[model samples]
Target: MSPRIGYFLSCEEYSPSQLIEQAKLAERAGFEALWISDHFHPWNDAQGNSAYVWGMIGAISQACSLPITTAVTCPILRQHPAIVAQAAATAKVLTNGRFTLGIGTGEALNEHVLGQRWPNTDVRLSMLGEAVDVMRQLWTGESVTHHGDHYTVEDARIYTLPDEPVKVYVSAFGPKALEVAARIGDGLCSTMPEADVVSSFKEKAGPGKPAQVGYKVSYSTDPERALDYAHELWFNEGIPGEAAQVLSSPKHFEQLAPLVTRDAVAGSTVHEADVDKHVAEFAKYADAGYDEVFIADMGPEYEGFFRFYEKDVLPRIRG
Candidate 1:
């Protein structure tokens, strides 16, 4: 197999029943896994989102029969790793071993709200490494009292932990984080499947570890509409600078926020051009040896989008 194919769902916006419907359609359409997003808010301006993730996950478990994981979540700053561990344990029991904990250092937008300190880039990565260490220890179904540099625990045990350790997939962007992932992670998770980054990560990240990538784009009947939506959300995702680096800094996003104006996000997508364009975009990641690719779209035309993909993209790409 050339690696699994997957998609993202917006549990926040969709009603519980609506989420079930789409998840069933996605699984039946042959997507191997479902990677969903977790957010306390939906960007700025309230975007009309921000649903409860735990409840949504519970509903998803009952409604669909496919593997699932958070594309990436920050368990450290906002929520205690203990809570995350408990939730993951319950979800694992519910899903029968179909969930993986995809974790990251976290962004300030979600982490800073609790009045907890949000460290700089390097420090945040350090906290993440410690958090993972702590989470794994707690998940062992043993009483743990970890006293680490960033996090500490006392006589903690999770009897509900699944029979085995939950695979911890670390999300990294640059060199340092990748090294952390290599040191502790069972798998690699990133949104950018850039070949050089993957190669660099694998090089320093060590051997025998698999790499996974996730990316997003919009779908529309008109090329311009698609590009517009894409740019609105993504131009910053590609905004030619250390955005590649400074995601840890809340100010970086605020500074770059102006560039991904309504126009930029809207005008940068490539829908209605060619299905090959979408396939080729994803194929580049597959070509880079990503063990899996999870893609999401942000428009209402996903039914039509998947129809086009199934008829035109999946046959050729899945081969």
Candidate 2:
């Protein structure tokens, strides 16, 4: 099948209503699907909003017919796997079996908000494995009592399940997490356009499993202004290594944001006026073997970005 192109809704920057509206706009624009960030908190002070994702999914289900996927949610700490299973099941039914549960080991920003200590990557992966097991077992619609190393589910059953099982996509940026995703995930979700990651996933998960990727673009007629917005709102993205995953809160990110140069953010995100440049950036991900490429607008405004992509970008990429 040809790769699908979708919109990446940044919940941290848009209200739930706005996100649903954007989903409708995306569908009207002929986009194939929607990917929403599942964050409890905004990355920094400038990008100011983080709506409850599950609630937004319910709204999006009513607003549009596009399939939905969480860019990545942590189902281990902030929520248990059993609860996630129920939520996914409900989401699937609401969207008419068009929902995909994209999950990850999680970041400190979202998972640590409940005052829980953030474990290292290795430990989190272990926890994620157990959590996936719990969620999958519960999805069987049987009374599942799972007492695993990281989670315990007592006589749990999800009654409101869809006809087909909700697809579970696991997010990964590193080696260990990649292995876990390949072994247990229904598909793969990632933010970077790394072909090696795809190679690794397909190598282990077999060649036919889906790999979905997300990329950020600060699309504006004015490239310089777009670059400035990207720097302000997503400079935290340029934080190298596991810092983006390990930082406990937005303040911690803010403390390091100044050190991130505008060029760094510009380099990380596609801050461009040229529609061709945006199309090429997306092509890289699709060419890298991603089954789906979800592009997020990093600029403050969405109308221009949406319009430009709808008119100029999507068609070229879809072709």
Q: Pick by TM-score: which candidate is best?
A: 2
Error of 2 at 20 (Å): 1.1
On a 0 to 100 scale, what is the lDDT of residue 84 in model 1? 88
Question: Which residues of candidate 1, in runs, are more than 4 Å off?
Answer: 11-18, 205-207, 232-258, 261-268
Q: Which residue pairs clash in candidate 2? A: none
Best by lDDT: 2
Q: lDDT at 240 for candidate 2?
A: 84
Question: All candidates' TM-scores?
Answer: 0.88, 0.97
* Candidate 2 whole-model C-alpha lDDT, 0 to 1: 0.88
lDDT of 1 by residue, 99-186 (tens): 8878887666667778776678888888888888788888878898988887778998888877777888888877788788888887
Candidate models: Cα lDDT each: 0.73, 0.88
